[model samples]
Target: MEIKVNDIAVDISGRKVFSNVSFEMKKGEMVAITGPSGCGKTTLLNCLGMIKTVDYGKIMINGKNVTKYKDKEKTKFWHDYATFIYQDYGIIEDASVAYNVTLDKYKMNSDKVQKILKKVGLEGRNNELAIVLSGGEKQRIGIARAIFKNATVIYADEPTASLDVKNRELVIELLRQCAKKGAIVVLATHDERLVNECDRIIDMNQF
Candidate 1:
């Protein structure tokens, strides 16, 4: 799989968020988007994930220009091929760990949930409530869900911003593992360690 951004620009309420941004990503690659505050790092991530639109240029995925895709098409693309990991963890606070991973879309079978959970270092915590887990554990559940969906493109926005050093390292390693498994992992981060671990860096300051 591949994604190409060609001289893209975005505006919000008469303000220019960014301009002339271009990048390319291939499967099995991990890319970090870095810049100072107000440089549009998260805005760029939203554009790549199809959640926001660009005011100029185009976004291409696998040779198809997705920038022109309609709302329905964008929704379908997000459902079938993309997933996001947020700094907030994005878990259903009142739900069980297994429920959070599968989100009731996949069967809640013990073996299936256990397998993915184990991969994220949350072994056998399936029945536990997400409300009680640590921030790192909650983030792991977010990654576990991404793995379960087999998403081709993973967009992570400040995924480790809330974690302690140990958990931060763990989350970094887990994201690296996802890239190695052939997913295009793109993240917006200020953490130097996470940025160093990426295969490529898109320094937004250059735009």
Candidate 2:
């Protein structure tokens, strides 16, 4: 799928977060949005994820103008096509890893959940509570969730910010695997190491 953002501008609370930003993200491509803090990288990711609407310009996903989609349609499309991993590692503290992996989807049975956990090297941690896991383990669970969603586009914000070297690599490798399976992996990150491995870099500073 191809994602095209044309002359996109966004303002929150009357403050300009992004202005006239435009880019095309093709499938199977890894794009890194990098800049210093407060450069609106996360805002751009939110816009791309449809968490925030642009004040001006158009957002086209896979050649369709998503601006035309109704709320229900947009929500369904978002659930099916895009998944985001937030900077804080969004996880349900009270849920077991298996539940987290299934995300309350009945079709995602225990067998599939266990398989995904193993795929993420967290097979034994399925029964563990989210809060008990290490930072890296939490991040892994986040990735597993995205995978479970079968998303075509994955947006990750500073995905490896709090991990040790080994876990950091694991996250990076998982992202690579996602891309290999034909998802558009867009990352908002300041890590030079992660940026270096990206297929393309959208340097927000240039805007």
Leading candidate by TM-score: 1
For model 2, residues 121-179, the per-residue Cα lDDT tens digits are 99878777888988899899889988887779999999999899999999999998898
TM for every model, in the order presented, reads 0.97, 0.94
Clashes of 2: 0
**Cα lDDT computed for each candidate against the true fold:** 0.92, 0.86
Tens-place lDDT per residue, model 1, 1-207, is 999999999999999888999889999999999999889999999999888989999999999999999999998998999999988899999988999998883666758788999888989788888999999999988899999889899999999997999989999998999999999999999999999999999999887
Q: Which stretches of candidate 2 lie over 4 Å from their true place?
A: 105-109
Tell me the spans in candidate 1 whose CA falls farther than 4 Å from its real position. Answer: none
**What is the Cα-based lDDT of residue 191 in candidate 2?**
93
